[model samples]
Target: MRNHYLVIFILGLLLSGCVTVQLPGGKVTSAKDVEYKQPAGAFKEIASADADKSWISANTGNTISYFSECGGKSEPTLKDLENDAFAALNESKTLSSEEVNYNERAARQSRASGKLDGVPVELALIVFQKNGCNYTLTYGGLAKSFSAEAAAFEEFKNNFKAP
Candidate 1:
């Protein structure tokens, strides 16, 4: 009886060692190399912890910001990101939005008006998903001067590259 008990214990140990365990995959932090051209002219690169990249126009006080989100199990859709952003701005209104192609990927471009800190503001933004990441590039300024950097924003969006 003791021998039999010892054999059973050894078998249990062997079986446990042979068992394969599956662990969940690690979440992706970001792409290996995220590359994009800055907006043209007086837009100077600025440091921003919230954004992967950012630029400010000295001439107009307009700003361009780019940020990325790593798509884990629950990757967000373009509309989801857009709606969340618009919701954050007080009195936000979408002036125009359309589907477009950027870097050979489907993207959405939008023009919006809203208030920030009770000060009127206008925004132009492009949203796209690529390589397990969602990216947003936005240009914003005082409502009165938003148009000053509108063209540069277009150029910046056109030059974006996904890693």
Candidate 2:
């Protein structure tokens, strides 16, 4: 059973269509064929785990994480990932959360705002499937500065080109 699970995980990663990201002119690569919008403040690349990818902003303690949850007999929807994203926030730290444009957009984009561990945060999550791979772009940051950061993320999402 363990080996079976391991094989499934490996196959999932393989079928997920992972790709090496290139920083073109200091631009951050979201995914394969996905566009990147230069953010306002300086952000440093942080080490990522084997599965989920992550980054952090310099000025603010904002962090963005990219997760690809695809590759099975059945595929998951953006709304499903959006709910999972919200549930991901530590419930103990979450003060309040409400949907902010949590509707079906062009690419199933969703937004939510809340307080996490005494820090205000805004979450912008986009779920998309491209090139037989499902992807989710999650952006979390200080709510006080969320507007500006959200603008940057919005620009990036706008330029997203799926292969």
Candidate 3:
């Protein structure tokens, strides 16, 4: 009887592993084929478990991170993601925001300034969705030199390609 119960439990586990989990838009095994040209400058890849790719400027402290989330049962809208982005910062306010086309899809670009660890920081965020995955690009640096970093971020943002 004990062996029979063990066999049943093993079968259940095997079946569960075989079961496919589908996302809202579709099934996405991983975020692949998304491409973007790195900004021209001394940028280095940084380690980030949460981000698919991340970079930091050797010249400036500016950093950029890109990530995608597999759609859930109810994927959040761009506005929702944008609001969440600002809310993640301390005392952040939108400086400007506009809709832009990104890889032929509607995308939102936002600029803001906020405090990080009590230090003033400037932020830029672009959010869009494609192929059952939501993509986000975040750029941030010290508020004082943010303008200088903006061009690099723009270059990176403009060259983004969705797979």
Candidate 4:
């Protein structure tokens, strides 16, 4: 009887070790595959100082919008834009100004360590304002799986225009 009990205990341990934790929706998929479809009329281009040079693109998926003001008297320099972007992130409780990269002009990069929807999440905000234009990029997702989203964020930034 003792041997039988020991065998059962060993089997329980082995089964426990093999157990895998699964989310409620079965196997989890990539956030990129989740399709962050922008709403109809979600983004509109408004004219800036230059013809189609300054504009703002609204990203509803991430609950944020990007504005680029190039070739205008109000056009913000890289430093000013970075400060504004960091401030915005802080407003959303996504990141703190000190946690993000503030000095880098070419790519002001910063990460906010936190969680969203019970998943480990990191928010990365990148701002690049130059030549009378400012670009604000933001992405949030699993901390370990941010590369793809980060690239998408950069692409969105690159598509900035003056309205």
Per-model TM-score, in order, reads 0.79, 0.60, 0.79, 0.35
Name model 2 segments beyond 4 Å from true: 1-40, 50-52, 90-106
In angstroms, the error of model 2 at 15 is: 22
Tell me the tens digit of each residue's lDDT in model 3 across 4-104: 32332222122112123465566544467877887678677766655677776666657777766664555678887677667656788789999988867
- Segments in model 4 whose C-alpha atoms lie over 4 Å from true places: 1-65, 74-77, 90-105, 113-122, 141-148, 154-163
Clashes by residue pair, model 3: none
lDDT of 2 by residue, 16-110 (tens): 22343433433323345444554445555555543354555665555555555333344455455556556533432333433333212335666
lDDT per model vs. reference: 0.67, 0.50, 0.67, 0.37
Candidate 1 Cα errors over 4 Å, as ranges: 1-28
Give the range of the ten consecutive residues with the poorest summed lDDT in model 4. 11-20
- Over 10-32, each residue of candidate 1 has an lDDT whose tens digit, in order, gives 22122111111223663645445
Tell how far residue 16 is off in model 1, in angstroms. 50
Query: What's the TM for model 1?
Result: 0.79
Clashing pairs in 4: 46-163, 47-163, 48-163, 52-162, 53-161, 53-162, 54-162, 54-163, 55-163, 70-132
lDDT by residue (92-116, candidate 4, tens digit) is 3435443233223454655555433
Q: RMSD to native for every prediction?
A: 20.7, 12.1, 14.3, 20.4
Full-model lDDT, candidate 1: 0.67
